[model samples]
Target: MSHSTAFASQADLAEKKTSFTQLSANAWAYTAEGDPNSGVIVGDDSVMVIDATATPVMAAALVRRIREVTDLPIRHVVLTHYHAVRVLGAAGFVPEGAVNVIASRATRDLIVERGAEDMASEIGRFPRLFQAQESIPGLTWPTLVFEKELTLHLGSLEVRLLHLGAGHTSGDSIAWIPSQGIVFSGDLVEFNAGVYTGDAHLAAWPDTLDRLAALQPQQLVPGRGPALRTPADSLSAIAYTRDWVQTLLQCARDGVAAGHTLQQVYADTRRVMDPVFGQVFIYEHCIPFDVSRAYDEARGIANPRIWTDVRDREMWAAIQS
Candidate 1:
């Protein structure tokens, strides 16, 4: 698909995709203004939540929504990845012991290592979701961890959790509800927003998207965009995310080959990708960090380095200035 068919421009696609829309019966998506989003699927006997919002307080609001719709218990909480904003609010979803919190093994390892640093970094990025910060007891740990793929029957409702290769993060997973014909694509496929590539695998992103597309989902709740209602729309969203990763990878390499500084590389990426992404949610919030990571990866840096408190502040100061 041509870039424009998927997007009028990056800005137009980002804005339209980031806005959330309801998908189907008992299914809902909570998206940002082009920021990260979570999904929910309520079953007959229990509820399966796609992701926990940024804080306990934010998660409480979702629980309230669930109560308003159905008294059925929330049976499982699925973490798409190990991002602090996505998994931290799990404490708010203390809906009973029956609920199985599931994540990839790598996600569990991430929680052990850099979850705290990421928590601080994201809190500073998104203040609205992290309201009642003290309400967050600590990082959320998955009760049930899996490797690769798992077929979970949440009561009569059949849900599929697949670790369909890494695109967003090393441990990225997607929640697929075949009964509803809907898939929660986590950050593996960003609808309209610029993919936050700090923890992303740019080279593998396309194939990951292809694996997700092969699922033949009729409705899709992308990690950051609106719910995709049509096949064409879904393809477009996935394609755009792939294009974004490729664009940044090429731009970073080009800048480095020309002996440019990190800032210079970022500027070059912006010049080309901006026309397509200038309007996405957190475009400004994400670009410097995204560029830095991409630059490092393009220059042969494997296994992303830890971002400590000092490193976070230093990057924030340098990038923001």
Candidate 2:
């Protein structure tokens, strides 16, 4: 095997221009090209932010964008999952009276169990994403935890926080605004961008996507990529993610059944998926991790291994080299 860069993302230092688009009268999406996106919902008296950016400094810019549209206080910060890039920016919202950081019970547990290790691993893998790494106070824990679903009323607007099974992570959740037919799907759905299945439940992801599509959301703010404004776009995003996950897992399962090693499986899966998704954002950065997890699941590993900086390098070496 030939040695390659430990992580493809190590060289991804270029900055992306941010866009803040209003999806509805009250909901807005703050996206930076294909970087992790944040969703903001303005209510009668306050605001609720879904998925804080990677750092406090980065999140401050999101707050500034929100201020440009409304002066409402940012009262809530929601973590779609326990990923470091999404939750580490909770502190940035404190100055805006961010009283509640909400997440599913499983997300809270994952944070307690591996948040520190994940923080280090993610920062090392994608340094460009964590702009002000020092600004992250510590692990961002949730103030409120729910089992399956929790509904909140931001003034008169109703927001439904639901854990519709697992895909990107065991505790993946989405914010659904029923009245407006809008859903803020975390990493559970990505449009024309690579899906990071590093910690994903590959076998269960397709079903979770089915549930998300059944919502019939007219507008959706995905975890990455541009916001899906039309119902057709929303449905397309769900179908695209579903196909990606299913295809990857099928390749892994076929490789395992044929007794291929991890590296071979990775290569085979890449050959199948690259033509379809290689040009998508972060596709190269995510493939090694995605295929590794898919291979594990196909071989009967129900849970993903914890990723540290050391493990990330080892995995990359094993697969890439």
Specify the highest-TM-score model's number.
2
TM-score of each candidate structure, all chains considered together? 0.89, 0.98
Off by over 4 Å in 1: 1-22, 95-97, 319-321
Tell me model 1's lDDT, rounded to 2 decimals: 0.78
What local distance difference test score does each model get?
0.78, 0.92
lDDT by residue (200-223, candidate 2, tens digit) is 999899999889989999999999
In Å, residue 315's CA in model 2 sits off its true spot by 0.8
Query: What is candidate 2's CA lDDT for residue 99?
Result: 67
- After TM-score superposition, the amount by which residue 34's alpha carbon in candidate 2 deviates from its true location, in angstroms, is 0.5
